[model samples]
Target: MDRARLAGFLRARREALQPEDVGLPRGPRRRTGGLRREEVAALSGMSADYYSRIEQQRGPHPSEQMLAALARGLRLSLAERDHLFQLGGFPVPRHAVRADHVNPGMMRILDRLQDTPAQVVNHLGETLAQTAPAVALLGDETRHSGLARSAHYRWFTDPQARTPVPAEDHATRSRLMAAHLHAAYTRDGRGSRAAVIVDALLATSAEFAELWREHPVQSAYCPPKRLRHPEVGALELHCQVLVDPDQSQTLMVFTAAPGTESDEKLRLLAVIGAQRV
Candidate 1:
């Protein structure tokens, strides 16, 4: 890796971001022109010292995962992210249909929705990032790996995937998940991640196999979602989706009607934070 050049690039990017740019408050006594190392590290999901060592050019070579996290944390564009990978002595990630990279504009919008139950999910139903309230509402959907990463895969195979939704909704939810996966598979043909998920589900999940035969397709509208939180009880919320066509990612924000019990429950969830419900 070109440690000097990498360090310089990282430093310049870090200095270019202000607290307000990333939805952080600027304290009255703050003197730094941009976000602190610790703030960047926190945003990147790494330790402050680990990030500092990179800027100092004294740490071990950063892995591709680390570079990707840095790119997201710094709100780098696709061009900037590819440059980061190159500087780290790695090949640029292939720009394809299954774009796991969350767009910087989307991240900025998500940062501003800290108190709202919101998350960024790719087309394959893999969650990329979530707000604290989202974790409280939907658990940490980003914690899964492999095929389990896709919600469509989990709905039919993992019982725990249906925990938040009521048992009565399971049948309808399953159909919806199937339809969503079918849409993704149609967009991304053979050998794509969507196809991989489909092939695996067809082999393993009898329910998914049965549904695949029906050829369900997702509707343009997203219906209201009903969720049961252990602490908050039943909450009927409306999900607002913002689509990023370029990245094939959707930003989902959940909210309840004003002056309703569900609205109060959502506010309570924000206070509960990310504590496992």
Candidate 2:
């Protein structure tokens, strides 16, 4: 760990905030500006002595979990949190690295492609936003919360999520999900959001456990996707993925070639969805 830089960053973040900002009372007798070291320790759920040692640059390497707590306590933005993790000599968790904000370029493209089935998803497979046609195709996957918010997490936990995934394709999807999550876990290591999902699955899913042992470790998998929509029946569409490196968000647009039955069904679904909206 870069103790000096980490300590400096921590101290700076603590000093930049007011007691009121973190929902604490500022007593009249308080002489120092910003929050005290003790307050930071309390907010971070660590002992004052341990926290002080870190600020003093004398402590052992802080784990990723400790850094995450510090990030939360300091109310660090996604970029700031990433800086903290870097200073701590740990890669920021991929899920933690995901920013919910869609960039203007992406937004503009989404606006122009209103009739297309498109959605933006973060690195963790959480849908940040979706076009109406995308919602109609995927059933508004952005509606989930907590661990279930991740499409990867829900594939094993929610049966409804697997409904669109054909029985023949279940193994492939499961392998893909496991492989992608494995890549995430490898990147972030322990105390990561991906680890949390893996832990939960290890405890609950026998299938996940088996696949985790023997799965393709590919991080990027893009194949022509098949969707079994109840209203539109079956659709074989090309799944195009656009990545924003700064935000780690993916724009997945579904398209079918012209003069195809899938193309007609896609447009019809868009019209139907727009009418419902």
Candidate 3:
């Protein structure tokens, strides 16, 4: 690894960011330029000492996962993220098929909605980024990877994933997910990420494979989703999706019907979620 170059790049990105850029406050006593190294470490999900070591060019080589976290924490663009990987002596991720990078437009929207439950998820059902409320509301969707990264895969392969959705909607959601995967698999063809997921689901999940055989092709995300939170109970929130065509990323914003019990619950959720975060 080009430790010196990597450290310099990380430092540059860190200094270039303001506290407000990453949903942090600039306190009255603060005198450091941009975000503190500790703040960056917190955002990157690493210890302050470890991150400081890397910045000081005295740490061990950073793994690809750590670099990925840093990229997200730094809010780097796709090109910049690739550059970070290259600088760390890691190959840039191939971008022809799968895309996890949240486009700038979506990031802007997410940045503005600190209280709302919003997330940028790719076509393959992998959540790329989520707001604090989203983490609280949906139990941190960004915590998984591999086949588990796709909620559809998790739905069939693991029973625990159905906690959010009611039992009644499971069949419909499964069909929708299966249809979505089929469409993506067909569009991308062989050896595609979607195809890999499809193959895995077909082999492991009989229900998913059954749903796939039915050839359901609904691509549009349904509105007014019924999601249950262990803390908030059942919530009837509308799911508004904004799609970025170039990146195949969908930004979903969740809001409840105003003046209703659900609205009151969502308001409570903001307070409850903040504490959880």
Better of 2 and 3 by TM-score: 3
Tell me the lDDT of candidate 1: 0.92
lDDT (tens digit, per residue) of candidate 3 on 24-108: 8889988877889999998878999999999999978999888988887788888889999998999988875338666756776
User: What is candidate 1's lDDT per residue for 1-277, written digit by digit as tens?
Assistant: 9999999999999999999888899999888798899999999999999999999999889999899999999999999999999999999898663277889999999999999999999999999999989998888998899999999999888898889898999999999999999999999899889999999999999999999999998987889999888888999999899999888899999999999999999999899887855
lDDT of 2 by residue, 172-230 (tens): 88988888788768877899887988899888889999998885586565988787988
* Candidate 3 residue runs with Cα over 4 Å from true position: 96-98, 274-277
Candidate 2 residues lying further than 4 Å off, grouped into runs, are: 1-98, 219-221, 274-277
How many clashing residue pairs, candidate 1? 0
Q: What is each predicted model's overall lDDT from 0 to 1?
A: 0.92, 0.81, 0.84
Name the lDDT value of residue 136 in candidate 1.
Answer: 88
Best-to-worst TM-score order = 1, 3, 2
Clashing residue pairs in candidate 1 are none
Pairs clashing within candidate 3: none
Pairs clashing within candidate 2 = none
Give lDDT: candidate 1, residue 4.
98
- The better-scoring model by lDDT among 2 and 3 is 3
